[model samples]
Target: MSIARPDLPRRLAAEALGTAVLVATVVGSGIMADRLTEDVALALLGNTIPTGAILVVLIMVLGPISGAHFNPAVTAVFVARRELAAADGLAYAAAQVLGGLAGTLVAHLMFEHAPFALSPTVRTGAAQWLAEAVATFTLVAVILGGLRFRPEAVPMLVGLTITAAYWFTASTSFANPAVAIARSVTDTFSGIRPVDLPGFIVAELVGAFLALGLMGWLLAPRKPTTVPVATPAE
Candidate 1:
């Protein structure tokens, strides 16, 4: 039941490494899916499965090290909750974002494509923005709920939630702001236009805070009552 506490450097390394692989899983699978299939639905299916699978594995492997928070949004929520210190959270966020960029480059190199190209995939619209919000909200909700009620099951829950979100949300659930920013630089199957990044990131932030408030309210313990037990006070 007890795990050895990793030092800050090790924890940050785990976060960076885990997030890099996770982003690679996403972008790599999408590239492979696109190259291997003509059906968009099937390609998305291919992309979704591996991304979710890797997420579960990464969380299971690195959860104890860095809480496996590959998303800045998740880190922010934890910081707000006092579960993570602000400085640590900032480091985790930086590592995740940098790792995501590295992952995108890795995927591009694997595909024999030029890296650091701005995405031309325009994913802008009101419905898309709303979808981003909903997807992020649900993701944070699942994370919070799982951590609260079933800590052991958080990895699987998060993976499944993301997989489902890919299918349900119009924006394909780019729920992580780090991911949204990283994807903007890759002109690949999983890429999004740089212009669209702001809307998605903002929506994700809004959704994260909304979920934080909702989970706090929903999971808050009932306050104990004080009974009047005065003896001889007249």
Candidate 2:
């Protein structure tokens, strides 16, 4: 079954709207979770469940419209694979960042906080950077592997992978550059220090491209070639 392809404008809108809702869920839930509990583990669990569930819903709803690439890393993969044009990929990235910022603001307003404030929560160091790399690599790998064999399962797979990554990775798997940047603008539960962003973004890029290259090799089609036959002598 073929999915309906939206034009650039509509696709961009879907990307923006989807990303906005995604970041809103992450930030809003993080805030609510923190307020509802004192235990960090419990708070994280509260933050994880809704984010995963919402990811599934968002991807299913918007995948047909915009491919549901809420992350620049994901967009970069598609662009590298030639599944998306360079210009369109740039547009998608910009929309994602803007939407993420807007979502952070929305979350702040919901919690009766200031519109924007730089986060002081520092998330850096080699361990965190490695975790981000592994997180992003796993995300892209899941996406590509699922799409190749089980396109229908991509949403759930991605959602579940992220939920799992949250606990397994030290950085809590902020695998999205846009999300990382936006979260830096908030002092809430989900925020990251802006100073720490460079490492995360660089790690994410490395991981994304690694996944692309690995998956490309793994999924490459085997072409059938004709072997020339020698004519029989009369």
Considering every candidate listed, which one attains the maximal lDDT?
Answer: 2
TM-score of 2: 0.94
Worst 10 residues of 1 by lDDT: 2-11
Give per-residue CA lDDT, model 1, range 95-177, as digits (tens): 99999999988988998988888999999999998999999999999999999899999999999999999999999999998
- In model 1, the runs with Cα more than 4 Å from the true position are 1-4, 224-234
Q: How much lDDT does candidate 1 score? A: 0.93
109-188 per-residue lDDT for model 2 (tens digits): 99999999999999999999999999999999999999999999999999999999999999999999999988999998
Model 2 off-target regions past 4 Å? 1-4, 223-234
> lDDT of each model, Cα atoms only?
0.93, 0.95
Write down the worst ten-residue block by lDDT for model 2.
2-11
**140 Cα displacement, candidate 2 (Å):** 0.3
lDDT (0-100) at residue 168 of candidate 1? 99
Error of 2 at 159 (Å): 0.4
